[model samples]
Target chain A: MAFVLELNGLTKHYGNIQALRQVSLEIPQGTVYGILGPNGSGKTTMLGLIMNILQPTGGSIRLFGEAPRADHRQKIGTLLETPNFYHYMNAVQNLQIAAAIKGVTNPDIDGVLEKVNLLQRKNSAFQTYSLGMKQRLAIASCLLGDPQVMVFDEPTNGLDPVGIAEIRDLIRRLAADGKTIIMASHLLDEVEKVCSHVAILKKGVLIAAGHVDEILAQDDLVEVSAANTPQLPELLKALPHCKQITAGDAGKWLLHFEQGTADLRSVNEYSFQQGIVLDHLLLKRRSLESKFIELTN
Target chain B: MNLNIPHLLRIEWMKVKNYKAFWILMILFVVSMIGINYIYWYVKQQFVASGDIAAQAAGSMIFGDFRFPAVFKTVSQMSSWLLYFPGFIVIFHTTNEFTFRTHRQNIIDGLMRKQFVVAKLAGAFLLALVCTLLILLTSLVFGLISGDGYFSLEGLQYIGFFFVQSCVYILFAFTLALLVRRAALAVGIFFIYGLIFDYLLAVWISRGTETTLGYYLMPLQVADELNPPLAELKKVIGSTNQWIALGISIAWLAFYCFFPIRKFEREDL
Candidate 1:
């Protein structure tokens, strides 16, 4: 797979404190990659280093198969931390400045504002914009150059539910158009709904990284209850595919299957062969939130 | 790396285009330049017509045969007081970027750190140019209306010196803004250093050394000596002193430009 961004043991230190400790990641092209971490987990630091805003204390980063530089950054769009802009200037004016910095003479500022739903207020001063409007305008600024890769640190921050939904839809549409997106978010559900791949970070360390499906696979939890509830635990322990059997609420026993075990019918047939009639059998898919908590802790 | 001058200038212009305070400061600077020069001309004209020997001597001494070079020198020197306005404008321009956090945004938008420095330098260069033109126009108009048409190109060197001095002041303000990165603090330090601190230190040092060289070597003092007051224009700065002051002023300007670039290049936003 082609990687749009590659980091090799990237690290950062602020004075005596280490912000990022040898973080290494490779974001494949055409994938919506999410960097999941709570506050102060070095998510912004990582993004800032890759965007060349902060100098890395150690290691290296490559963009589009070469060392990242100012010129190479032209192909990537970034919105770091907050929506920073000249509050005295309006949306169009600010975007024009951004366009000029990107070496774009005739950027479609109107089209970008329209995409972010800020076209009607394009001429209003930025100071007059609400928090949500300011955020949307920041997104519009990032979209000015039609970059191949988009790096957003908390892209949905400060937006209302409707605004958040709109931004989520926009991210999906951009990813559908083959744009690689790297979003740093503390919102677990947001990542679960939007990301194709995820890397969980805790305390400046990478805890887990993989495709979303592989990281939080479907039907990892199976709850089974039968008339012989007392015997269910023993039978579950004897099954070769069952990784762990624990007593659950309401006289049901929870079964955790080993990796790649997705056969519910076999478990049911084994129970019947053992002369045990099962009254209830249900499969529970583990959520990304629980998986994230498990890995971070 | 090849710096795209035009594109960077466009970026700089976009920053200040709709800024109300920027325009207000610029307008006040220009109007003050014209208004003050006109008032001086009116007072000089009245003195010249008084027919009193003392008043006439004072008038001629102040206005000097209003010709090509002297006119340029006198008008340019008169407008020198207005440099602080533009200096404040430069301060505002630089600090506003920090206030708005647009300096960091500019880098994220693909501007090299050095390019951001270059853009501000380019903007300062343009401001200096406009200031020089205003000085020249103000001198030309007042010279024609007031003096006995004894036009000559002999004193035009003062205009060049004035332009250089304007640039030095603007760059000095830019350096302060970059160092402080806060509008009020930078402006405060700029005024305190230029108005009170530098002068006081220069005076104390000059008295101890028994030579004004120490005073003349200071940044603002060097620039100020380049365009001496009309009364002591020739006596205060000799040709040798002029060369020394020019070299020192240029050195300070260079420091102001490069030092900020160095600082911004290494600092984290």
Candidate 2:
């Protein structure tokens, strides 16, 4: 597979405390890859290493499948940690600086600001901006030069609900435009919502990683309780697609089925044909949050 | 990226052009530098006008010092005391990166570690050059005001020394700010050390060894005799050799230039 970013045996140590362990990840081109972890789980450290914000204790990083050079980073737009702009300068000025560093000439700062919904306040000093506006401004900077690869670390941090939704929507839109986005967040729902691929981390160790659907739980669960619960298991145990049968709370039987194959009506009809009167029946799709909890814990 | 020196300076300008505090500090530096030179010249003028016995006896030393070549040393020395003003500007500008964490952002935006630090060191260099120009302008004003009509580039090396002195002061502040990464703490330590500790350390070393080694030992102290405010104390203090001081001062300059680049380049931002 062609990779946009590749990390090999990457490790980081802050004094004696290891911030990131020996873990490797490869992000394919055109995938919205998410680095999901809790706080202090080395998510930021890993991103920092890739961007050269932090030096790795061991191993190496490759950008666009080549040895990373400073200019190689020019093609990657990044908002690491916070919206770090000159507080005294306005948004247009801040993007101008970013453009200058990226070697972009005659950059459309207003265009990027418009994309991030910050063009209206493009002339306001960054210090006067609210946290949400500041974050949007940072996203605006990341959009400057129209880089193919973008990395956002906790991009929605310090934003209001509407701001978070806007950012998420923007990320989704960016991804849909075939831009390769590598986002680092502790937000499970965020990864579930916008990420095509995900790598889970816990305390510097890689827990799991792959396509989101492949890595996360894709099971359909059925909760059925009959007045004679004993007879329900025999009926559920023989179901064609049922994978597991376990006793649930309140005298209910929970049966796991392969995703999208659990037919609830068919299960109820078969249970009734088996002379079992079902008292309650419900179908529950396994949430990514629960799967994230399972993987992280 | 147009990361050449001029482009680098242009980018640096973009950062500080709108900063009110930067302008305020720069204005304060220039005004105070010119202010001190003017006041000193005015005092000497007042003494010369008094027509007293001692004033008449020292007339050549006072009035003649402000003309032609001597005016360069006179203004350079007078302006040296206000080096802290520009030093503070350098500290604020550098530590502002850490304070705002823009250094990291700059690096993420494709600025090499060397480029970021080089830009900072370059800022200090530009500031030093500006301070030197101010000294030059002050020297010309003093020389023209002396009315001796005898102007020569005889002691112009003193003005050059003043430029080097300015670089030492500002880059010393730059190194301190890079290490501490806090404006207030860096500025505090810069003033407290440059004003108090550097002098005391040199004095202590001098008094202990009965040699000029002490004077040339410290970075700021090495340039003490360059734009000397105290001329008579040279004989009394057994002043350091100019060549030795210059050599040691250059070593410090190298430190001030490369240390920040090396530190930022080698470590995590």
Candidate 3:
């Protein structure tokens, strides 16, 4: 597919309760796509449906441009919801089962364990693992076979701050290596920092999608200040593509503009050409948390 | 059924090979199985010695419990009672998957729903075979040692019946674990339903009749009639026709084998 994954009106319900509604989106190849939502917003359910863990009540899914199949999942790495392993099996043994299922003739089990920093404790049973270690082991299992597409549901759910950052970097490095990743998380900041493309789900509805900047651009804000420049407000308002110019705290003017129109250089050059450049110019992009709350609300 | 069972079973073996509880239970089962038979044999020897001496003067003997054909029947009857021991293995393994949510992971790992369920049933089938093999070996030892008429194969068919019954019991336990999705509850229900409830109900329903609805009850009760404790009990429990007993066992077999495949495919993990 032009996209690595596609969902067309995917819907699921548990008897009278709807867990996921019609969610249709495409995850393009080579992009780290995020399914961003809050708890019970259907992120995990959506991921489960895609991986065939849960059957959809209504909809169609296309994996790599074909109808979804079990082997299609083999070509992709997926960790749904939690780190599920045999409590009695060690790390090497658990990954061996996953590798066998994925048809990987030889998986670098030790390499992945080392990558997740679980090599020292590789022989420990999963039940002995702390939550972060268990989560790391799950990620290590996903890295088996070096799949081109990887899907993770809350990859850093139980991680401490350092572990979370490490996982985020691993996701970034994997994406940089040209792999397509689909990660579902309730952590909006995680998605904002990591995802190139995003789909926001709120209460089972797909509320927003497309490029992250485009989604975050709905409330793009720019702060402009000059050395006691009396004409800054008038100049900002008169500038092209400026949505609004309003006064802000500590003697600043907040200029609102559409996505690309919020280019800080243009504000500087425009003010300079108008002989208004003097002190400060700043781009105030909205955090995903606010965007999420706004869109979800 | 699609011939991927070997690979699936290999994957299954990987899970249990390092599982200490599985091997512990298995060793305990085999040892207990053989040990229980030895006890029964010793008790039979004592009973035969004490009771037959007086009865022999009256022109009858009571020393045939371990005779060539009777030994086969006796061992199978004993083995059938311990089917639940291996059945707990099935319950633990099955419910452990649900408990750990690895059931979902297995599906996520690229096994078709059919492949996963079939592999599980295959595991059950193998476990039954293992139990049957143990029974067969024990029967041989007891029969030969008893000097039971030069090792006749006359009643060897009971061992085959034992395998069938074991498959039903283990798979029924697996079905309970899959449906119940919890260990204690599955074990509890299995004991209550398979042992007490099914037995008393089937017995009441059959009422020592030669043929009746109770003879076909599922899990253990259906097979209880097939396992001949008293030669006369066989006639009262199952129909005089062997085909009917075979048919009921096969029906239970087919249900346990294929129904779970369908359910796993349709149900959300």
Q: What is the TM-score of chain A alone in each candidate?
A: 0.90, 0.94, 0.83
User: lDDT by residue for model 2 over A1-297, one digit each (tens)?
Assistant: 789999999999999999999989999999999999989999999999999989899989999889898898888999988899999899999889999988899999989998878888989999999998998998998998888999999999989888899999999999998999999998888888899999988999988889988887568999988885586787668888999988889788898998899998989888888888888889988777777778888
Better of 1 and 3 by DockQ: 3
Clashing pairs in 3: none
Which digits, one per residue and each the tens of the lDDT, describe model 3 over residues A48-72? 9999989899999999999988889
2 or 3, greater by lDDT:
2
Among the numbered candidates, top DockQ falls to 2
Give stretches of model 2 more than 4 Å off.
A228-235, A272-275, B1-3, B57-64
Interface RMSD of each: 1.0, 0.7, 0.7
Candidate 3: where is the Cα deviation over 4 Å?
A218-240, A245-254, A258-285, B1-3, B51-64, B207-211, B232-242
Candidate 1 chain A lDDT trough over 10 residues, lowest sum: A212-221
TM-score of 2: 0.96
Clashing pairs in model 1, backbone N/Cα/C closer than 3 A: none
Stronger candidate by TM-score (1 vs 3)? 1
Q: After superposition, how far is residue B260 of candidate 1 from its true place, in Å?
A: 1.3
Give stretches of model 1 more than 4 Å off: A222-235, A246-253, A258-285, B58-68, B231-240
TM-score of 1: 0.92
* Candidate 3 lDDT tens digits, B158-218: 8888888898889889988989999999999997787688867776776755337675754
